[model samples]
Target: MELTTSNPAQPHGMTWLRDDRYSWFLAGMMWVLIVLMIVPEGFDYQRLATASAPSSGGPISRMLWLLLLALGIMMVSWRAGLAWLLARVLNPFFLLFVALAIVSVAWSIDPALSIRRLIRLGTIVLACVAFVLMSWHARRYQNVVRPILTIVLLGSIIFGLVFPALAIHQQTTPELIGAWHGLANHKNGLGALACISLIFWFHAWLTREVRFLPALTGGAVAVTCLVLSRSSTSLAATLFVMAVLLVLLRSPQGLRPYMPYLVSMLVALLLIYTLAILNLIPGLGTLMAPVTALTGKDTSLTGRTEIWTILSEHISYRPFLGSGYAAYWTAGPVPGADSYAFVWRMGSFYPGSAHNGYLEIVNDLGWIGLLCLIAYIVVHIRQSLQLLEIDRHQGALFLALFFQQAITNLSETHWFSVQSVDFVIMALATTALARSLLEHRLRLVFGQPQPSTIGTSHGMALPLARESFDRTPDGGA
Candidate 1:
């Protein structure tokens, strides 16, 4: 009679193991970093330093890098619904990356090389999907975004201050004609970084529980770094997002409570305008500093506009699929006798990137692919804007990210290569969350009992928290 068995109570941490939130958070981190490593964050210059082969960096390192990523994702994921939702949201765009690989099957001048590049692109996307499925939560999502802002701000500062100093230190040593190397490859990439980071910090300023001072300082530095990057697109985007911040401050019905934000924005705008009219804005210096440190006169943006013009002309050629993945104007030899005569030419210099992302896509993926990409992003941005309109904090962050992406894709220096990874992952996660939220709102409006969904407060947990979990552990339990 006394042989009754008792079941042990699960600790909170053990229960948390069953919680999709915890599993998803880990998955999200894997999604962010694994894709970044594979996509080659500095391909803008890394390809130049070494041969493009995965072997040039060594086969062992590349193999180990990918194997480790696979193992990590396998170890963490616990849910299948997350995977399917992730796929449903993102599978449409995989067609573009697959199109890159398919191009090699049909038309690679060097089939082997093209196949290799195609495989690389597919692997990156697949890895991104794996990470996104596991880590699809609003809080974990913030972890990935906030660090990105830091990296961009740090990279911008490093380039703005250090690159010029390095050039001056070795100007006469003659290692090269210029030294514009930031932590990343070029200013455009850094500018992309700045643009995204600016939006992120600006969101942090609005949504987080923290005091405003830290976010304000972060926003200023992000804007300064973006301006110093001297990318007109980045500058324009910063201003646009700043406008968004002002709107957020004023949109709340209780305007009197936010008088401080209104006053601060007005002051900031006035000061920035006054300084610019006086020709004192720092971006003006970025144009001259590189050459003045070495020679006398400012160098032209080194024919950037002319090169852009050349790429635009090429867009007419492939009006469909321009060239192929990683294919562009950079591959051809300048064979004319006049070509050899140009004194302005830098040594062995060639750029594969089209500088204009829209043109670049049209060249590589063809008209169909280009149209799909544009439509995909536009739809997501439109949705995010709607979400923000409803004052949903997570939706606002998505809106900020997509807005930055829409701007920086033009005249981008290095973003397309590195950012494909982050783009797909974020896209997968955002769409999943948005869709689930949409379904919930629809059910409530129809007066239908809400359908069960993971992480949904309906059925599983009350929308009103059972009690304050922050109270004493025993009390809450």
Candidate 2:
């Protein structure tokens, strides 16, 4: 164990630090730290008024803050995306479009523009940096993906579920509405988060990265918190995402046969919505009757269904790039007290967060960008799933994270919001890990030949590789 001194040209006893495996471990560690920091920020960031944020008066310049981090990430990741990751699966234009979309946010007219910019920048840029760094390490080591992600998720549960419950119970105010606050802002976030965690937990158990005992407990807490949040949309998001994941990972003999879970979850959601509409659920209508009778309005949904009807008209006008980024929510994404006009006019709250990430893309970046985004989702999901099915290291966990985010995106914004920290890190880091896991699985599944080892830099798939980017701060989040 004795260590020898070394000359400037040669390394000393810490030679393992230079090993590719250590690099990967450090990368994973970096992402875990980033998520831990970001998740806390999400809970508190929304409390500040726009005037309190950095560069709060700029017209559309706040976007620069967000993009700066992405640039920093790209710089750190020495491997550019043009190589294999993008080339192997993507059309390349999607990456370009994401860049354009970031640029386009500058034209947004939201009065809180500067504050909005800082908030988004802090959330997304930080996430991008963490992900890129993790991805780079993963490029070489490949197998550390699962354990690293599991660490983030377990830690998230501590804040997202456990702490929120304790905080709610401690507060004596009758007006206090306690719900799951996992990385995002509301109960819907908890629902989405619960589903996401459940997927990861299940994935862990399924792949044996984690034991089953803890998985059930974690999954149960998440789902229970979602139920307490009382958000129909979020509740559905949790069940549907979980059901989909179970289907993907389950064997024919597994519980509910997977397909049944899928169908049952969807049916359950449809029934709930339908019941809400028809006033048909057992006691729901009785409760609604009194509330509607008292208010002379269908306060349920806070009138989002109605607003969606009205907004559906505008959505058609500029099917592409409608209004601008974070636009359209002049009426919120879900029913709530957030949008005064929509809430007042309809006697309920308009939706916040647009309720759908895909539609929001079409509405914000226009059809062109939306198409590219769609392609990315499709390709990414397809590639991720391929890995999940093979039962490799953290492959299923990656798919679970992606699925939870995508499914929840229908009714909540998990990509770049106060609640976005953990999921974003989980998605990006896990996905990068999944790429290699998939390749390995593919090798195993088909008994294919192994590729050359890492560091054969010539023509290596390095596009968007996390290591290619640097963690240099750009006076940003």
Candidate 3:
């Protein structure tokens, strides 16, 4: 009898797993998942109403997401091994915050609702973790993400033009009458998508990732949608992030050391402006008046400050641990229900959030939760800044996304919302940056070959697996 030795890591008939096919399939699944999230139920109004009920996601969608998570976990186990995957996903702060959310159910005003929302949030975070582990290269990450954003942007435009009744705001508030919601349930949703696409396509153009004409075309589409949606917050956040990205990406290498200081100054200015917009800083309003006017908003920031004032009172009730994870807004979805007391006070409107991420965190998880979230963001920011020294393009992209999220969160809450597209991307970006930084440090310590170089851009090329298993070549990272 011939003695055949087998590797435990690679069981018999597992040769099929040595290719990039799984990566591509996972990327496609991610695209589908994002699409399902941003554009739900074929943009059918009635279906959207039922789907948008308090539960973060419908049953079918949750199951599909979980299925994708399972496939991703299995792929990581087979390709990179669970330990390698864990190294990327075991972010301490993220885990702590999640654990806090889970434990908060004990004190939640509505434990059942908290439990349901917590389940959805858990799925989202895990899905993001899997996306990070499976995405072995920055270029692959961009490839999977860019097209999804572009298609959604373009689809929104087409939807607005072809189905005006469904896509355009109808018998709503006087100011919002003609605003375009497109395939999204709200105009701000469409605007947020457009803003992100604009930033991405612009970055693609800057880095020559896509042809100039195609990038320009994508940006133009995004701009059209942004203008039609009339989402001032998205517009402002998009501009701020784009400016930061341009300075970081286009500046000469000689100025890299000073980039941090420059960015700090910019962030300071942003902080002051955010405070002014929230009416927290009475003095800076005059300084920001011109800029705010350009965005077509009044001193009240379209009544957001008022909402903050009202929500602040509620937050004061449970200032420490919070009302419980997603428990504050437990009222029925009716127009004039008792649960909408805050909403009615704000504007007799339903914004579905505190209009601020920091406030949302405080309201949901309390000051402790806010501290954990800030720590989480700080850790990712440090990683991205360190990444700038190793890979400019990827680092700038990550940093830009972080800044955009920060800016948007000033006027919109996406920090922990299960249905938020921005939160999803932010999670993916955080994990990718963490993985890349960890890999770079490990290589330095182990004296392994530096990460594979691609082009002259100093980009980190992460192979899909260990050299022994990455038999199928990838196009590029």
Candidate 4:
């Protein structure tokens, strides 16, 4: 598509509106992508008995997703072109991870399922790349992100209040009774959404990027949803993430140099504490038993430990490779094949996940894939840290998201997902991080100061989308 143009004879408001059409389109695509994946499935007790999550809406929802994604890809191709998007999507470590996932299909107990899932994951990744390109290149990251989150966050409250049967937890388990699932399938999902919403709006408020009243309202609603959801892990993760953000972003100037060391020490302490609470540290767990009980969970962590133990035994059977990418939890076993036995062992409470992200990877792709994942995470984090030197707010936002995902995965499987909100957000953050680092490097090498996407005051300024229309040496748009 060509750059939208408003003739000089047109009114100023008309010009502005014409110039911003791309921005509105970008935001609209993002809303569709995020909202469809995160929207509630209504309350279904039958889903609790099943091991896997339901598909991400019906055929119409998927068809719409694909249509938007195709348009986004075309826009990116025509405007910024494929080179930059490819650079971000085809990073070496990430490529290796994808390659491993593809290779796993060869050894998969269910090759058909593995290949199907790989296609789904690939489509999600492509959408993420297009999303990042449009948002970052156009300097509309916040414009694209905040409104979608606001809608989802606020809609959760409305849904819960007006349609309690669909939004509130039903009689699935004793512990989940009376809890609000909101716009998610489970209370924990709602808690996680609220936790992230709280963190994001709070950051906007702290940086003064957003005005007080609206930011305060967002944060307040987030807190209310979080409390009503009653997801202990999300609650704990939010507090820790907020504390870290405060120390890093709000600390005195003199303490800036020591911040890294302080943060490392704090993280180490938290890890040790978590290990003890989970009884992973031998005698320390016994000592921390009472403390764990106080948190409304025992060492079993609501039966997650038992699930992990069974999963570990199965993972040992494969050791290096794995049963298959997304094939281990089939609905039924092939005759004479033991691969789908986990579904039965998990009984009626089958959680479709290993309850641990790292373990989930191992169960699907084995130790080699686990290593690939670690490398991918490390590479992106290193780039994000480099971005910190160029833009604090952007870096801090990415870090908050990274840590939140990492922490939540300790007790939930939020990684390697194609449909979850967590996956979508992380994809955006990581892609943006890469784009920022690359742009910073290019500016330094060429000695040209690129215009800042994020304002010096941490606000985002929408650059004229007409910049994408700048003529190349060959007179291309």
Best by lDDT: 3
| TM-score per model over all chains | 0.62, 0.58, 0.83, 0.80
- The RMSD of every model to the true structure, in order and in angstroms, is 11.8, 11.0, 7.2, 7.7
Instruction: List the candidate numbers ranked by lDDT, top first.
Output: 3, 4, 1, 2
Question: Per-residue lDDT of 276-323 in model 2, one digit per residue for the tens?
Answer: 543334566554464345324453344445544544455577665554
Better of 2 and 4 by lDDT: 4
Candidate 4 local Cα displacement, residue 193, angstroms: 0.6
Q: Can you tell me which runs of candidate 3 are displaced by over 4 Å?
A: 1-21, 47-59, 72-91, 278-287, 334-338, 343-348, 445-477
Over 4 Å off, model 2: 1-77, 80-97, 103-184, 220-224, 231-234, 252-303, 313-317, 327-351, 388-399, 415-419, 422-434, 437-477
TM-score of candidate 4 on Cα atoms, chains taken together: 0.80
Judged by TM-score relative to the true structure, which candidate is superior, 1 or 2? 1
Candidate 2 lDDT (Cα, whole model)? 0.44
Q: Which stretches of candidate 4 lie over 4 Å from their true place?
A: 1-21, 40-57, 72-82, 85-92, 135-139, 266-295, 331-347, 445-477
Candidate 4 residue pairs that clash:
none
Question: Residue 204 lDDT in model 1?
Answer: 69
- In order, candidate lDDTs are 0.46, 0.44, 0.70, 0.65
